[model samples]
Target chain A: MEKTARREKNIRRQVLVVDDELVNRRLLGFIVSRDYEVIYAENGIRALELIRKNERLLSLILLDLLMPEMDGYELLEILKADPALKRIPVIVLTSEKTAEVKSLQLGAADFIPKPYDMPEVILARVRRSIELAEDNIIIHETETDVLTGLYTKQFFYQYCRQHDRYCIDMKMDALVLNINRFHLVNELHGREYGNRVLMLLADNIRTLLNETNGLACRCEADSFFIYTPHRDDYGELLAEYAERFRSAIESSRISFRLGIYENVDMSIDIEQRFDRANLACTNRRSTYTSSYAVYDTQLHERELYNEKLISDMDKALEEKQFRVFYQPKYNIKGDKPVLASAEALIRWIHPELGMVSPGAFIPLFEENGLVQKLDHFVWREAAAQIKRWKDKYGRTVPVSVNVSRIDIYDAQLEEKLREIVRSNGLEPNEYLLEITESAYTDNSEQIIDKVNLLRKDGFRVEMDDFGSGYSSLNMLAALPIDALKLDMQFIRTICSSEKDLKMVELVIGIARFLNVPVIAEGVETEEQYLLLKKIGCDIIQGYYFSKPVSPEEFNKLIEAEQKEELLC
Target chain B: MLTIDSLREYGADVDDGMKRCLNNEGFYLDLVKSVIPDTRIAELEAAIADGDLDKAFETAHALKGMYSNLALTPLSAPVTEITELLRSRTQTDYSGLIDTIKKKKAELDSL
Candidate 1:
């Protein structure tokens, strides 16, 4: 019954009173203070000051009308004027009961006839005010994202509908900027870095908006919606803003492609506007350009093409539209081949569009968000080929497959690759996962983690396409990889250009120190192959020995190797 | 003379509605914090003090929500009322009930 009694006490109504007159304030203070948490204001000014200072503690105020300097009438006007301060129940306690109606009109809670009200009547009004305040707090929490303190998507929609805030009808230029490949950044760089980037980007956007007289809103995640009211000069403003964004991107050294659309005439709905901008980004990404594009008719066509590509890609995965071709790696130092590791390269034979080079379609697959699936398909296929090579050659020659930066962005990527290899019953040592050097430079730690995970799982990680990008040597020096694949560009020019030869010599020297094998790619001529041999390249792969062959042709090459081995 | 029953009867009609209003204001403030590039919460005070009617009204509208919720219905009206009284920068009414309400508010808090 104690608990029940406490519960009852909690529900019991309470009020708060403020007054300055020692007797008049206390008389009222005393009568109502019993049923409430009685508070005092010695004078009208003190009362206003107290209320202004601690507005939350108040439920109601029994304001006296006649007071020196700041009277009850003045306080009432002020209270009624403030929406938050106005709601506290206030009964005008004054000598003139005849002014009760006027006091009510001035927004008083109630006019208690001045002589002294029955304590019960005063208590009743105070209880009424406290009940109202409690309900308001509950409603506020539902419509917002607590962390970012932004309006939830639900509230955003309401604002859009009622205020024409984001609608085309407003003739405003609202652009939604989504951070490109943010998930990859999150996976490869770590969430803390991703969040820091977001915060910095938000600050920069705000500063830019203020400078350009534009308005920006954080819509969700890394996506921000910006609205500029100056419709007549939007084009000029956008051009100016683009430079700022470009400089910010370069300074941050983060690769991103942006989508922007300006609607001056309020010509479309929010969905269409967002869709067009997304389409523009899709087209821009397909072309591998790190530039922002405004939506146009071409964006719509690009969207359709992207949609078709995604749909076709699902079928492509199942029907084996993809095939693995092996470019043979040569053991040039021994004069004859000591080992021949196959470089796993993919070719797409689209039914309508035959012979799609990976260069032409690989980006589309990545932009259409199918790179992970492609990676999976390639992993399983390459594993099967490795199994076949072991069976035929009686030796498990390791095959290296190039994993796109997109594939490494998933934090679970190692697990996925491990699962596929385990399911295929293939030894991890027989396969190498090659990731480009540029992939690690922007997000070194994340790539390091990925490489560490793969190495722990007994797979060799090769830094592929090395020496062609800004991050190549730095990453090679930093990352824990077993091998480095020198880009064909360096190898191709080694014989023709002294600068290329010097760089190749430097790369080979570094590889020796790191104890990582260096593989020279694109060794097309006898001079290039001999130069790489003299430079101490552990492996060489190019048209000099053989072109990338189909599985059947590779099997034939393996058969020829068997005969050569017998002859040896 | 006020009684518990009388108090209940007086505020029962608008109690929930007032609470809902206050909550809505809190939510708007939260949204402003989230999306505003530089977070312009301090600017709101200057707008109210300087008698910028539009800025003051917008802020009052938000506060009115909270005031209405606490059943401090009278407190919520100042922004709207002052906004009207101060039509422009020079016309504000800085007297009487507004002051009274503030005092009563202090007394209420002490309770």
Candidate 2:
């Protein structure tokens, strides 16, 4: 912002004298000649042309009341209408004392009585009007955003408060409309191009303010905050805005997410209203989901729930409240399903609430970056459980645990997992890692490099939730993985829908080509299990066999596996 | 070679006019001499004859400002009178006032 702040460099002392009479132009010019450089325009037409060229350079305009071609009064009206020229103060040159009132009404800064006579009075009036206009230009720059003529945030907030005085009873909504992934647009097109986009957005915002009668401010760089009387047509308005941006950029990449706190609770602070609206706007900002989100009752409750989860997370982690559970995965290649390995899952047993679903907290933790702590907790706990089973059954049964994208980014992640395995008295193969397929699609080159490093360290990495994202078949070839774990949603309707079953078959075919096993989860019924087994899916984990259960219950399966009757 | 004394005889307020030109007598008389010869004085007469009162008012008003600025009261007085009449497009015998302005202009031109 400091780099972009505009600076005024030139000194302003150029005075324009507009009069048909040479005596008056010479007289006024001579009076101000010592302090200023005078530009002479014999009539209003010539003066206007000079003003257009030297609008910034001019300090003041001394206009005569009458001239041929264009009179001072007509010129005054023209000057008053132009935004750029109107700021330069004009002092009417007149003999008629009665014309003074009309001149003032027509926007004369002051009047200089017609006469070449008083240099002292003439210079003083000229100097005062110029000084006042200069000061006003300075103030104008501060109040307005340099790129957009919209008010700067501080002044915008001030003006919004002022609006309360006039329309206290009107129900207003605070809206925050954001350009999603704007930095990407900047990176793709240069910053100057980005500025043009912002300027166009500001123009659209000006139109919105005109229609709704509100106060708008351009927030830091890529968003705008508008406080206006409640309008229930935001859905249509957002669509219109989206269309405008789409045509402007000539690409569908110009998407926006608008959040509104409708009929705002005035009891709350204004900033907080915008904060809630901003929260709603960013609800799925990272994902290509909804275009607009209102901060409604449900979203408000969810906000509170997320807040509570954040507050209680640290305490829960320290208190051993998170318990790791294992869902048994059986090798389906044989006649009888034999227990192969278990997938580690977590269940939060809150002291007060008794049982908090992982669905309720995992996403919250993942978004806020507390998932790394929870992931580390599950990693260590699952390793210890594997050791416990090895001690009892005398076999190193492998257990796959989730490795989040955050963990893959962690430089210490491989070392941490190896340390867990070493401390648990197990091999790297005994402690498998499950990396989500979607995480591979983002930062593929980097995550692939890290996964290759981990694979070199002798860890088997399974691509978890294989069909969940835009995993191009080309990308699958790039991912360094030991197995493909079919996303459970694919299995939900596999028996009913031929497309889903064929999709699963296609994935299994790809797995076979890669020469890796396919582990299908969420196979709940016999029909789904038989169909998956027929498709050459090497493993299965679902309620048909067992839901994720306590290690104590899983120990029973381990005992059965030791006796060679795991599941029959 | 219009001196301040001659300008005063032509009914110019030399002291006030001098004060306006930063008390410079040379500049004040120069302005008075310049005011009498302004071509708009001729334009004002032409516009009056043509019945273009708007154009007449513009020219008369300009003469009023110039004569009044130099404090050439004899010329300024009649110009101002006709200027006011032309201001509202008041149709009247502006000829008498125009003649008086012309006579004062000749008096100033002679000075």
Pick the DockQ winner: 2
- Clash number for candidate 2: 4
* DockQ of predictions, in order shown: 0.02, 0.42
> Which tens-of-lDDT digit does each residue in A137-244 have in candidate 2?
887888789888888888887887788777889999999988878898799988987888888888888899998898898878988899989999988887787778
Q: Candidate 1, DockQ to 2 decimals?
A: 0.02
Docking class of 1: incorrect
Which residue ranges in model 2 land beyond 4 Å of their true spot? A1-12, A44-56, A69-89, A96-125, A131-150, A188-207, A232-255, A262-276, A279-286, A291-568, B1-15, B24-26, B29-62, B82-111
What TM-score would each prediction reach against the true structure? 0.42, 0.50
List RMSD in Å for every model shown: 20.1, 12.1
Instruction: Give the C-alpha miss distance for residue A324 in model 1, angstroms.
Output: 1.7
* Candidate 1 segments whose C-alpha is farther than 4 A from its true place: A1-307, A472-475, B1-111
Report the poorest 10 consecutive residues by lDDT, candidate 2 chain A: A1-10
Share of real contacts kept by model 2? Answer: 0.88
